[model samples]
Target chain A: MERVTVILGERSYPITIEAGLFNDPASFLPLQSGDKALIVTNSTIAPLYLDTVVKSLEKLGVNVDSVALPDGEQYKTLSVMDTVFSRLLENNHGRDTTLIALGGGVIGDLTGFSAASYQRGVRFIQVPTTLLSQVDSSVGGKTAVNHPLGKNMIGAFYQPASVVIDLNCLKTLPKRELSSGLAEVIKYGIILDADLFDWLEDNIDALMSLDEKAMGYCIRRCCEIKASVVAADEHENGVRALLNLGHTFGHAIEAEMGYGNWLHGEAVAAGMVMAAETARLLGSFEQTDVERIKRLLVRANLPVHGPESMKPEAYIPHMLRDKKTLAGKLRLVLPTAIGQSEVKGGVAHDVVLSAIGCCLI
Target chain B: MERVTVILGERSYPITIEAGLFNDPASFLPLQSGDKALIVTNSTIAPLYLDTVVKSLEKLGVNVDSVALPDGEQYKTLSVMDTVFSRLLENNHGRDTTLIALGGGVIGDLTGFSAASYQRGVRFIQVPTTLLSQVDSSVGGKTAVNHPLGKNMIGAFYQPASVVIDLNCLKTLPKRELSSGLAEVIKYGIILDADLFDWLEDNIDALMSLDEKAMGYCIRRCCEIKASVVAADEHENGVRALLNLGHTFGHAIEAEMGYGNWLHGEAVAAGMVMAAETARLLGSFEQTDVERIKRLLVRANLPVHGPESMKPEAYIPHMLRDKKTLAGKLRLVLPTAIGQSEVKGGVAHDVVLSAIGCCLI
Candidate 1:
């Protein structure tokens, strides 16, 4: 078992990583004997893992209920979250009830925000099934449901009580979803951890093949990098903005393409390339570094560029609606190097457009 | 001007009380010259005060926008808040935008929750016009819109940057609305300030007549008590629950009667008497104290008993949905004396029934 602490003062909790942790209720979570645990999954993951999760919670004497939402990123919206709220109210779930987010990033984001708003707020634990969630979304407490105008435009910074990642769950992950997780795993390396970036370059095949040790190391390192950054700036007022390295451009792609049409990690993978291209043009990044990032994303089977159909100028409208926009200026996290990034606002419209242009084809 | 500070560490802000403060931008709010300030009021208040508030923000060189929602407690719902969200996105409001909630509790709650959820969260200022909001909702950071199933069932604990209370606004209040505010004023006296209770008794006639100084003191005192309680428990984990002294029973009344049918404060006024009666039967409160509370409520023109249409059994359904319920047990705040209260749970279901029966007129 591997454990990492997300230090958030008194609200801090541990993220435990181990195989088959989902089946052992006694050791996985800190739930009390009488706590009501609602496992929030999706139609897809529920059949695969719901019974095991429920039986585990029942073993710990937790009153268990389950609500499986319709699966997909397109279902991540306020309207969908309202259904979760309806389920909770119908079941007489109180403030003390513990909500367990039991699937991928979409489920985690929706469940966390639902817990944040239901009866004002409630305690929730993260049982992230997807690699994208276990490495990024589930650890940071950045929970939200997307609005039609923007991706993740409506949400809160509510943290989870605990995060339990069972590596065995990944064995069932579709090949496409596995690559989606690697996009974020690659993100941690490019933004803050140079060593992890190099490690990814060497162990790419092992991670893709679902080697147990390589997978565990990849998830743990990404969480550690995320935990450190989130601890310093929970509200994203400062260095936390660095975590959105590709998100501004990526969100534009997701919104313009319509959510769930393209996976979040796929959009982010292309967006990161656009950011690196922007940095290269601005004289902050070497052309070789940009090529290296593109090469790795291509090898991992992720998108290496924006949609060929979307003209560079088309992304501006959605980018304008991006949450990172400060004082009407489009603030973006552009990479200065493979192991470093900085938030740059007020970049000229043409410069942003040209960067997107560089990424097409 | 009088000021009370709600100390929540870095999130703390002042509650400023004065006459004609709305027009004095220099003396009000912490807004910057270039910040976009969105004034959110209801239709009822827009015709009366929206122009003045916009001009005030304009005087400080703030770029201003305004949204006027329909007035009424029934309008306080997630759908209504969604409209506010739409207005914000349509107007291209960004992270730096400051939302000013300018109306009664309904408008304040809707706007505050909108602020809390819009773009994840944004800074907001509270300009509570009615006494209910001025004293209670505005002082605490409790923000939410109601669900069809429950009052304040969906919300957040997002605090404001500042709370502005202009005594002049209350002069335009309806007589019934003024009485509704008085109910909460009397609540502060009963729960934590015996002196405020005596003061309400002595000045009931003057307050009913809308005496300026009397009304100012009443609102300020209530704010001070609320500020103190919220500072200790921003999330309502401990001492903060006491602030909901009669709210469980009151929420039941509000939810059952249809939210707009019975004003929140009016229901709370009657609910307070029910709580007193329960305490009296439990030997935690004296009969004389119950009479004192009821007499003061009546003198202030507030309801002193439950609606005859709602039988004891009718409340159980709604009470079960109350946010205060923990571990499936309905935790209620009951007065142990004239000026002190305690959280009491596990009372017999029949005991609760008879208590409601005692309050039915």
Candidate 2:
């Protein structure tokens, strides 16, 4: 087992990664002996892994119950959170109850927010089954549900008690979902880690092939970067904003395309290209770096350009409403080099328009 | 203007008490010039103070937008929070926006939770217009919306930038609302300060009559006690639980009776009496202290007994689900004496039954 600690003072928790940790309750959850745990998963994951996870907890003398939500990003809403609450309340789950999120990003986010809001907060553990969650969403404590107007627009920065990532669960992930997660993996490399960017370039084929050692290393490195970043800025007041490298444009694309139409990482992949293009126009990033980023996204089977249906005009309104915006000014995270990024706010409107135009297919 | 600081480290904010501060944007809001402010109120308060609050911000060159939700505690739900999101998105409110919760506890809670979850949170200010909010909810940062199954079952501990409590608004409050606020004021004295209890007894008439000095002192004292308790235990891990003196029983009453039916403070008044009775049966409290509590509540025009319709069985199910419960044990905050309380978990179920039977009219 490999472990990474997110140092958030007293709220800090561990992220454990192993191939079959999901079947090992002792290693998988941060639950106390005899604790009551409510495992929240989706229908898709429940049939496959819920019983094993449940039995593992029961073996540890922890009382266990389960609530399986319908799978899909479109179902990530307050209504679903209400459903989780109903299940817990119906079963008499109280403050002492532990909520274990046992699916991918959507489950992790929904459960985390439910834990954050239910009874003004409760203990929750994350068992992320998808690469998108294990490497990113499940690490930084950015839990939220989608709004009709935007993606991840309603949520909180509530940290988890622990995060368990079992790569064996990824064995069942469809190919498209696996590719979707690579977008975030590529993100950590592009926005902060130059060495990792080079590492990804060297091991792209290995990662795509599900090379255990390579996938484990990639997930750990991204989590380490995220842990350090989140520890320093849990509420996204400063440097933490850099982690949103492609989220501004990506959110616009997702919002425009309608949530679940374009998966989060797919939109982020295209969004990163637009950010690089914008940075290039600002004379900070080089053309070669932009091309290199495009090449990587292509190699990873990710989109390299924004959707043709979303024009610059359509992107501007959503960008303006992004959480990154300040005083009505756009705060875009742009690459200065392959491994470095900067958050530049108050960029000219025309510059953003041209950047969006540049990324159009 | 009178100010009490809730010392929550970096999240610390000031609670300012004065008459007509709501119209004084410069003193009431912690907003910078030209910041966008979203004033969230209910239909009741919109007709009373929305324009004045809006004009105050507009006077300060702050862009002002308003969303008036339907008035009443029942309206405090996720659907209303969704409405808040729609209004903010429609007006292009960004992270820099400051949300102003401008009504009673319902508006403050709904708006505060909205700010906590909007775009993963934006800055929010509390301008509580009712005595109930001004004394308690606005001081503590316990923001939430009610679920159909429970009161405040879904929420977050999101603090405001500042809380502006204009005592003049109490002039417009119905007599019942004034009495409701007095329940919390009486609670501060019961749980933490005996002297405050005596003072409330002495000034009950003055407070009921809306004497500015007495009411101001009452509100400030409650806030000070609340601020200290919240500062020591922001997440209610220990001493903070003491602050929920009558809340467990109160919440059960609220949920069972239906939210907004028995106003919060009314239910709390009755719940506190029940708690005193329970403590008495446990030999920790005297019958006289219970009568003293009952007398003060009666003097304040508050209920001193649980609803007759809610039998001990009905209370047990809801009480078992209270946030105060731990490991299936009912953690009841029973009064040890007139001036103090203790959270006693693992109390006898039959004892609780007798206490409820004792308190029922």
Candidate 3:
């Protein structure tokens, strides 16, 4: 097990990464007898893993309930979260009851948000089942439900009690979803860690093949990078915005593609390509570095390009509504290099448009 | 002007009480030039005060936008807040935008909640227009929108940047509303202020007559008392739950009566009368104190009792939904003496039922 604690003063908790972790709850999470626990997942993963997780929890004397939302990025709305809320209320779950988010980014984002708002907040554990969530969304403490007007417009920065990353769950995830998850794992490399990028370059084949050791190393390193960043900027007041390197453009793509029409990680992978292209145009990034990132994503079997359906203009309206925009100024996070990035406001409309066009070609 | 700060370590801010504070924004809340400002209010208060506040903000070069929601507590839903979110996105408001809640408790709670949720929170100023908000809701920084299933079932304890209680707005409030507001004023006296209770006893006639000076004193004092308690226990972990003296039963009444049917303060006033009776029966309070509280509420023209329509059984479910419940235990705030309290969980169900029945009678 690889361990990293998010140091949010007294509110901090640990993120434990262990292959086959479901067999031993005590090593990762503190359990109490008769504790009411809800594991939030989706239809896709429930048939594969919910029974095992529930049986394990039941063995620990925990009363377990599960709410499996429809599978997809489109389900990450306030409405879907209401399902989790209703389940909690129906069972008379209180502050002491723990919520376990046991799926990908969509489920983690929505469940973490539901836990954050249910009775004004409750303890939750992120037992992320997919790579995108285990590496990024589950670790950041940025929980939110997507608003009709903007993605993740309503939320709270409530940290989880702990994160339980069970590598065992990933064996059932679809190849497309696994690649979708890789886009975010690739993200940790692009904006924060050069060494992780080098490691991804070396182990791309094993990770793509779902080698347990390779996947475990990938999830642990990504979480470690995210944990360090989140510890410094829990609410994205400053340094955390760097984590949104591809998100601004990515959200625009997801919204334009009518959400769930595109997996979030797919949109993000394409958005990263756009970001690198924009950096190259701005003379901030080498053309070779941009090509390297595109190839790295391509090697992971992830889509390394934007949608042909979206005209650059179609994305402008959605980007304008992006949460990063302040008073009509769009904050674009651009990579200065593979290892680090910057959040700059009022990146010219034409620059963004041209970059969107660059990705279309 | 009177100023009291809810001193919650790094999260504290001043609550300024003055009649014409809004006219001169700089003295109370000076906004940085060009800062995006969202003015949240309802239609009823919009025509009355929005323009004046907008003009004041415009003069200072603040980029102010208004979200005028439908009036009445029935409209204080997540759907209503979605309208505010739409306008915020339309205007491209960001993390730095300051939200000014420009009406009463509904506006303040919704606005503070919107601020809490928008981009994971923005600064908010409470420009409370109603008596209930000025004295209690404005000071505590609890923010939420009603769930269809429950009142304030979803929310956060996000504090405001500043609170501006312009007592002048009360000049337009209806007689019933003014009476409803007195419910909270009566609450402070019952929970933790023997001196304030005595003052209410002495000035009930003047307060009933709506004496401006007396009203101002009462509002400011209640805020000071509330501010002190909130500062001590910002998230209702301990001392702050005492602030919910009548709220456990009051929430039950609000939820049972279908929310908005009994005004929140009115329900609380009636609930306090019942809580006083319970405390008396439990030997935690005396009979005279209960009578004194009821007489003061009645003298101020507030509802000192509950509706005969609700059965005792109907109230239990709503009480169970109260956010103060922990581990499925309904922890209630009961007054121990004239101005002291305690949180007792596991109060007998029959005890609560009998207390509810007594209030209805």
Q: Give per-model TM-scores.
A: 0.98, 0.96, 0.97
* DockQ of candidate 2 (2 decimals): 0.78
Worst 10 residues of 1 chain A by lDDT: A26-35
**DockQ score, prediction 3:** 0.63
User: Residue B318 of model 3: what lDDT?
Assistant: 78
**DockQ per candidate, 2 decimals:** 0.75, 0.78, 0.63
Q: Against the unseen true structure, what C-alpha lDDT does each candidate score?
A: 0.88, 0.88, 0.82
- Between candidates 2 and 3, which one is better according to lDDT? 2
> Cα lDDT for residue A24, model 1?
94
Model 2 earns a TM-score of 0.96
Q: Which pairs, if any, clash in model 1?
A: none
Q: What is the C-alpha lDDT profile of model 2 across A1-361, one tens digit per residue?
A: 7889999888889999889886786865568577888999999999999988888888888989999999999999988889999998888888888899999999999999999888888889999999999899998788999888877888988889899888888889987888899999999999899999999999999988899999999999999999999998898998899999999999988888888889889999999999998999999999999999999999999998888777788888888878887767788999999888899988898988898888877
Clashing pairs in 2: none
lDDT of 3: 0.82
Which residue window of length 10 is worst by lDDT in model 2 chain A?
A: A25-34
lDDT of 2: 0.88
Judging by TM-score, tell me the better candidate of 1 and 3: 1
